[model samples]
Target: MIKTSGLSYAALAQAVNRLGYLAGKTLNYSKSAVSRWIAGEQPRNPVPELLLEVFRKKLGREFTYRDLGFDIAEADIEIRSLWYSDLSTTLDVAPLMWSHDVFRRDLLKSSAVAVGAMTAPARNFLPFEPDRCRSRTGSIPVSLGDVKMIREVAHQYWRWDSKYGGGRFREQLVYFLHSHVAPLLGGRYGEKVGCGLFSAAGEATMFAGWMAYDMASLGLAQRYYTQALRMAQAAGDRQLGGEILTCMAYVANSAGAPDDAIQLCEYALDITKGRVPPRVQSYIYSVLSRCLASAPSSPRNRPAALTALNAAERHFARPLDGSENAWVAGIDFRGLQTQAAHVLSELGMTGRAHEAISVALDGRDESHRRAVAFCKLYLGMVHVKEDDAEAAVAAGDEVLNLLPGLETARVQQGLARLQREINSLGDTDPIRTFNERARTLGDRS
Candidate 1:
C-alpha cells in the first residue's frame, strides 16, 4: 500500500502529523517511524486511526485497521459494520452506534467520509423487498401509542433543531433513541404495529443523521442515514425512504460530490413520484434543484436547475388540507424560497438569489432562527457575488449577531465561505471590520 501510494516515508509522517495537529495532538514521527510501521511495527493509539484517515483521503476511499494489516478488535468490527449490514444487523447495530456516539465519540469522529459507502445503500434500496413479517419476540409488548409517542418526540426534536441548531439537543436525542426507542424495536409486536414502529424509528434516526450533518460529522451522518434508509425500507414507507435519500444527496453535494448528489436526487424523485403528497414532492424537487445547481456548471445543468425549481414552486402552490406526514409539515413556502435562493445563487443569478432569500427571510421569527441565519449567510454570499461590499458587510453583521445562540457547523461553514468571498474582493475598510468581527465570534464558537 505504501509503495502504490507513492508517498515517501517523510511525506507519510508529515500527513499523519497534520491530522494529529487538527485533533489537538502533537505528533512528531520521523521518516524512520514510518519505515518501522512499514516494516511490520504497530504504532500506538490514534496513529493507526490517523494512518487510516490519511490513506482514506489520499486514495479517496475508506480503510480499516484490518485492511492495513493491523490487528482489528471486535469493537472496531461492529463500529464499521453499520453502513453495509443487513436490515436485521442494522437494528442490532443502531443502538450500539448511538451509545458509542454519546460515550466514545472518538471512535467515529476520527473517521473520514467514505463516498463509496453511500452508494450501496442507495442502490440496494431501489429493489429492496419490504420485510413481510416484522414480529419480534422480546420482553415488552409494543403498541401504537408507543409509536405515536416516538413520533411526537421526533417532531419536538425537529422544532428544537430548527430553532437552536443540531448541536443543542443532539446528545439528548441520541440517548432517547438508545434508551427508549431501540428496545421497542426488539419488543413483541404484530405486523401492523411493527411497521409503525419502524417508520417512527426511521424518522427519529434520520433526525440523528441531520444532527450529525449539522455538527460536521459527515461520516457518522452517512451511517445514520443508511440505517434510516433501512428502517424506512423495512416499514415499506417509500416516501420516507425518498426523503432520506434527498438528505443523503444534500450531504453528498456539501461534501463536493455533486454528481453523487444529482444521482441520489434522481433516485429520490423516481421512488416517490405520485406516491407521496404534493408537499413532499415539492420538498424533493426543491432539494433536487439545489443539487442540480451545485453540480458542475454547464448549459444543461443551469436549465435543469431552473426546471426543478419551477417544479418545486408549482408543487408547493397547490392547495393542501393539512393531512401530510409529520415530516412534510415543515416544507412551507419560506423553506421552498430558501432552497430557491440556494439554487439561484449557485447558478450565478445574483439578483434572483437576493430576491429569493429576501422572501425566505420575510416574517421569519425566533422559531426559525437558524434558518434565518442561513439565509442571511447566503444573502451575504450573493452580495459578494454582486460586488456589493456594504450589503455583504451588513449580512455578515446579522450572521454574527445570530451566531451566539446557534450551535450548527453549517452556519459557521457559510460564514467561512462569506469570508473567502470577501477576501477575494481585496481587503477594504468595511470588509476589514466584518472580517475582524467574524473572526472574534468564530473564535468563540
Candidate 2:
C-alpha cells in the first residue's frame, strides 16, 4: 500500500494527528510509531481504522484491517458487522459496543471509523427483512413488560440529553445498556417478545449514539450508530433505521466528506418515503440541504442546495397527524429555519442568509442553549460578510457568554471559524480585541 501511495512515515504520522484532532482526540503517534507498525506489530483498535483511512485517500480504494496484517481470529464478527448484524447477533454486539464505549476502548477513541465504513449499513438495510430478526433465547426469561421499561428508561435519557447536554448523562445510558439490557437479551422469549426487546435495545442504542454525537465522541458515536442501525433493522423499525442513517450523515458532513453526508441523507429519504412522519422528513431534508449547500462552489451543488432547502421548508410546513415519533418530536420549524439560514450563508446569499438567521434568532427557546450559541456565531459570520465589524463582535461576545462549560466539537469549531473571520479584518481595534479574546478562549479549549 505504501509503495503505491508513496507516503512516508512522517507524513503518515501527520495524517493521523490531523485525523485525531478532527475527531476531538489526542492521538499523537510519532514517526517511529508508524515505523513500528510497518515492522509487523499491529496498530491498536482505532489506529487500524485511521491507517485504513489514510491509505484509502492516498490510493483511492477501500482497505481493511486484514490488509494491514492485523490478527482478527479472536474478534467478534457480530461487532465487526455492526452495520447490519442479525437480530440475536446485533443484540449480542450492542451491549458489547456500549461496554467498549464506557471503557473507552481504542476503537471508541478513533473517530476515523466513520470516514468510509458507515455507508454500507444503509445500503445493507435497503432490502432488509426486519421480521426475520427474531431468535431463540438461552436461559432467563424476558417479557414484553421488560421491553416497555427499557423504552421508558431510554426516553428519560433522551429527555435529559435534550434539556442538558449529552455530557450530563451519556455514561448512564451505557450503564443501563450493560447492567439491565444485556441480561434481558440473554433471557428467554418468544418471537413477539424478541422483536420488542430488540426494538427497545435499539431505542437505548440510538439515544446513546446521539448523546455521543452531541458530546463529540466521534468514534464511539460511529460504533453506537452503526450498531443502532443494525438493531433498528433487526426490529423492522424502518423509521428508526432512517433516523440512524440521518445521524450518520451529520458525522459524515462534519468529517469533511460532504459526498458521504449526501449519500446517507438520500438513503434515509429513499427508505422512509411516505412511510415516516412528516416532521422526520423535514429533519432529513434540512440535513440534506446543509450537505448540498456545503458543496455550493459547484454549479450543480448550488441548485441542488436551493432545491433541498425548498424541499425541507415544504416538508416542515406539512401537516402532522400527531403520530410523530418521540425521536423527531423536537424537529420543528425553528430548527428547520436555523439550518436554512446556515445553508443560505454557505451559498453566499448574504441578504437571504441574514434574513433567515434573524428569523431563527427571534422567538428562540432558551432551553436550546447550544442552538442559540451556534446561531449567534452564524449571525457573526453574516455580519462579517456584510462588513459590520461592530455588530459581528457583539454577536460573537454573546456566543462567548453562552459558551461556559460547553466544549462540544461543533461549538469549538464554529468558535474557531469565527475567530479566523474576525482576524481577517486586519489590525483595527475592535477586530484585534475580539481576535485576542477568541484566540485566548480557543487556546483554553
Candidate 3:
C-alpha cells in the first residue's frame, strides 16, 4: 500500500493565507491548526475544500484530497441539481448561493467561464418531470403563488440601488430574503407551488449576484450567477436565463474578456430568438454593445458595435404587448442611448460620447443617482481629455460627492482614471482640487 503524507496544520494555514492573496480576498486562519493538519489531523470537512480552493487559486491548479495530505477521496460533490419538488434540497442550495457572495470574490470573476466549459457541451441538465413533485405539506405556500410580489420587491431594491447606489441596501435585502423569505420556499406545496417558489428563488439569486458584482466581489458574483442560471433553468424560465446570461456577459466584459462576453451575449440572443419581448431584446443588445465596445477599435469592430446599438434602438421603438413585463419593457430607446453613450466614451469618441451622455442625462430622472454619477464621471473624463481643466474639475466634483456611496469597482476605476488624468497635468491649479476630492472619495469608497 502507498502511504500519503499529510500537511501540518501550520503549513496548511500558511498555504491558505498565500492562496488568499492570489484569489484577492483575506482568509481567516492560524498557524497552529495548519500544524495540526500536517500532524495527520483531518483538517475538518469544509477545511479540506477550502484548502483545495487555496491551492487552485495560488497554483493555478485543481487539487484532490491527496494534494492536501489525505487519502485520495472520490471527487467532491457538485451541489445537487434538485427540482422544485425537492424543497429541502432546494432550500439547501438557495442559502449556499446566497451566502457565497458575502465572502467569495474569485468565484464571481472567472467561474462563469469555468461553468461555461461544463455547460457548453450539454446545453441543459438532466430532464426531470415537473408533474411528479409535491410540496412538503399537502398545501402550497402563499409566497410561491404570489410571484409579482417578489418581483415588485426586487424592482424596488433595484430602484434603491439606482438611487443610493448598490452599497446602501444590498446586504440588508440579502439578509431579509435569506433569513425571512427563504424558509417559506421549503414549505409544503404541490408542483405548481414549488415551481413558483423556485422561480422566485431564481430571481432573488440573480439580484444577489448583481449586487455582488456591483460591490466588486467578482468571484462571489460569478458563483451566484451560476447558481441563478441553474435555478432559472430548473424553473424553465427562458427569460431569466437570457437575463442572467446578459449579466454574465457584462461581468465578463468588465473583467476584460470581450470575446467571451460577445459569445455569451450571442448565446443569450439565440436562446431568446423570437420569443423574447422587444424590450428584453433591446436590453440584451445594450449589453452586447457594452461587450463589443471593449473589442479592439478596428474599422470593422466599431461598425459592429454601431450595428448592435441600432438593433437595440429598433427594439426599443416597438410597442409593448401586455405580456411584456413592465420592468423589462421600460428599457427603451433612452436606455439604449445611455448604453451607447458609455460605449462611445470607452472608445474615446469624445464628441459622440458627449452627445449621447447629454441625451441620456436629459432623459434620466433626478432620483437615478447612480446614472447621474456615471454620466458626470464620463463628462469629467471627456473634459479632461479635451484639456478643459475647469470643466473637468466641476463635473468631477459631482462624481466625487456621490462616489463615496457607490460600491461598484467600475465606478472606482473611473475615479482612478480621472485622478491619473489630473495628475498627468501636474498642475497645482484648482484642477488638482478634483484629485484631492477624488482621493477623499476613494478613502470613503
Best by TM-score: 1
- Ten contiguous residues with the weakest lDDT in model 2: 74-83
Model 1 lDDT tens row, 225-320? 888999999999987898999999878887787888889888888888887778888888899899888875666888998999999999998877
Q: Which candidate would rank higher by lDDT, 1 or 3?
A: 1
TM-score of each candidate structure, all chains considered together: 0.83, 0.79, 0.74
- Among these predictions, the greatest lDDT belongs to 1
Candidate 2: pairs in clash = none
Residue 204 of model 1: what lDDT? 96
- lDDT agreement of model 2 with the native: 0.76
The Cα RMSD in angstroms, rounded to one decimal, for candidate 2 relative to the true structure is 7.7
Error of 2 at 358 (Å): 3.0
- Please provide, for model 2 over 158-199, each residue's C-alpha lDDT reduced to its tens digit, 9 standing for 90 to 100: 867655667778788888998899888888888899887877
Runs in model 1 lying further than 4 Å from the true structure: 1-84, 321-323
Candidate 3, 1-445: lDDT as tens digits? 0112244546667766654443333567787766577688885444565576555445544456786678745332222221121334345656654444334523323332233232231143223222235445624355444666767787788777767766677777677566655666655666676666666667777777787677666555555666667666656666777888888787677666677788888888887768778778888888888778778655677778878887888887887876665457656555666788777877778999888888878867756777777788788878877888778788878877776556666677777787778667658668666667667767765
Best first by TM-score, ranked: 1, 2, 3
Over 4 Å off in model 3, which ranges? 1-91, 99-140, 143-146, 297-299, 404-407, 425-428
State each candidate's clash count: 0, 0, 23
Q: lDDT (CA) for every model shown?
A: 0.83, 0.76, 0.65
Q: Evaluate residue 335 in candidate 3 and report its C-alpha lDDT on the 0 to 100 scale.
A: 60
